[model samples]
Each structure stands twice: as C-alpha cells, then as structure tokens.
Target: GAGVSQSPSNKVTEKGKDVELRCDPISGHTALYWYRQRLGQGLEFLIYFQGNSAPDKSGLPSDRFSAERTGESVSTLTIQRTQQEDSAVYLCASSRDSYTGELFFGEGSRLTVL
Candidate 1:
C-alpha cells in the first residue's frame, strides 16, 4: 500500500500480555499520528509526530501506551500489560507537513484483549 500500511490487522491477546502494532506511512510524509477507536466510538488521538519535533503524547490514555516514529517513515505503537479496556481499533495516519493537507489513514489494527 503506497498510502499507509499496518501489520497484523487483527490481534487477540490474553489480559496482561503486551502487543505491538506497526505502521508504515507514505514516503516523504512528515506528520504521523496514532488514534484509537472503541466500538461505536469516535477516533481518539493518541499521539502525534511531526518531523524532528518532539512528539505530542498528551492524548495517550495511560503510561502503558507509547509510540515511536523513525524519521517520518515507520511507527510502532506498543501497549504493555494489556487489559480488556485497551481493546480497540488502532488507526495510523500520515500527511504532508502542510496544515491543510488531508491525512491518509490505514485500515487500522483491531485488538481484542481477553
């Protein structure tokens, strides 16, 4: 996928387990973001990375969740000690540096904790 690519489209993990979700954005995109959506709920921003600037992680739900982006290319979202409440669709998006550009989103990785 030239737009955005995510691996392990669906995941089921035991409670207290850890999971990693990966994202590859379009080449040259300078902005990347991670969002979560629970069933029947709107997307909630988790983190944002733009260029060399420090990432904005204030939207993360807890300390157990974190994301890393390498040079605006690929990003990995890690969730530690997963719980049922952490189940959701994790969406990745990327866009050009311009503020007016539209974000290209991945199909999302669905996580289910049991």
Candidate 2:
C-alpha cells in the first residue's frame, strides 16, 4: 500500500483477553508512530520509532501496552490483559523522518473491550 496500512480494522475482545494490532507503514518512511483516541477524545501519542534509534515510549498509558517496529517497516501494538478502559481506536502513522511533521495515517484499528 502507498499509505500506512493497519489490520483488524475492528476488534472485539473480552476483558482480560490480549489483543494485537498491526501496522505497515509506507515503504520508505523512516518514522512510525502509534496513537490512541478514546471516545470523544483527542489523539494521544503512544510510541514513536525512527530508524535504529531507541523508540520513545513516554506516552504509553500503562505497562500493559507495548509496541515493536522492525526496521522501518511493520509495527505491532500489543495490549495484555485488556480492560474496558483500553477500548479505543489505535492509529498508526508514518513520515519521511522524525522531523517531517507530515504523517500518513492508517484507517486505524478500533478495539472494543467487553
């Protein structure tokens, strides 16, 4: 895909279950980011990866949320022991580099915890 692509556009999981969301960024983009948007809320940064640099994970809401990116390609966000508050739209985005500011976003993966 020419733009960022995310899988499992919609997910419904029971509380305490684990969920994994995937994202494939543009072929040449060197920076990838993960964000979360809860109902009626703004986008909240979760993680960022740039080249081989250490990812910035300061925005992760809790220890149960983790993400990994392989090189400049695919990235995955995992939620362990999911809770109701974890329900939200997980958005993935990518750019030419960390400074580009212009991000190409995916359609997003919507998670619903019951």
Candidate 3:
C-alpha cells in the first residue's frame, strides 16, 4: 500500500523553460488529482481522473499546463514556458472518491522560477 510520492521535492528553473513533474499514486485508487499551491494561497485543482471515465482538466491554469494519468496509477504534470508566477508547490493526491476526505497528498514538487 504505497502512498503518493513525487520527485525532486524541489526544482529551480529559469523563466520561459519547460518542466515536467511526476507523481506515483497509491495502488488500487481509481481517483487521482493534481493541485497547485502558490505562496499564501489555497490549493487550486488542476486536473482529475477517475478510472476510465473522462478526465477533468478544467482547473489547469493556461495552455502551458497539461497532465495525464495511466490506468489510474501514475500521473505527470507538464508546464511549458514556465513563468515566475508558476513558482509553487505542485501536489498530487488520490482517493477512492473525489468528494471523499480521505485524499492523501504527496510531499509535493516545489518549483522555483527565477
């Protein structure tokens, strides 16, 4: 029963570059979600996928961001043309249901745009 996990824990990059963050969710969980938390702000839902159902990408910030999930297991978030405003902690969570409070979050992938 592995929990959600993320890579690099921290990332520092220059503006206008591209970055890809990875996430590994718990096994047997059909619901996965991606969220972003900027400084002094709340978590913003980016994308969510449940089983073979249609994936929800409504919360993505701009055309520069995208995500994908495979077999309800792993997910990756990509940011193209990174801006300073994109600097924040990209968090991944998964639960049995989106409305459930049992969602678990990884340590988060922290990105710094300079």
TM per candidate = 0.94, 0.96, 0.91
Residue by residue across 71-107, what tens digits does model 2's lDDT show? 7789999999999999999999999998969999999
Roughly what TM-score does model 2 have, to 2 decimal places? 0.96
> What's the CA error at residue 38 for candidate 2, in Å?
1.0
lDDT of 3 by residue, 6-107 (tens): 987999999999999998888878888889999879999898888635466789989999887777777889999999999999999889776666998898
Evaluate all candidate structures by whole-model CA lDDT and list the values in order: 0.90, 0.92, 0.87
**Colliding pairs, model 2:** none
Please report the TM-score between candidate 1 and the true structure.
0.94
- Which candidate model has the greater lDDT, 1 or 3? 1
For all candidates, the clash counts are 0, 0, 0
TM-score winner between 1 and 3, please give it.
1
The whole-model C-alpha lDDT of candidate 2 against the native structure comes to 0.92
lDDT of 1 at 71: 73
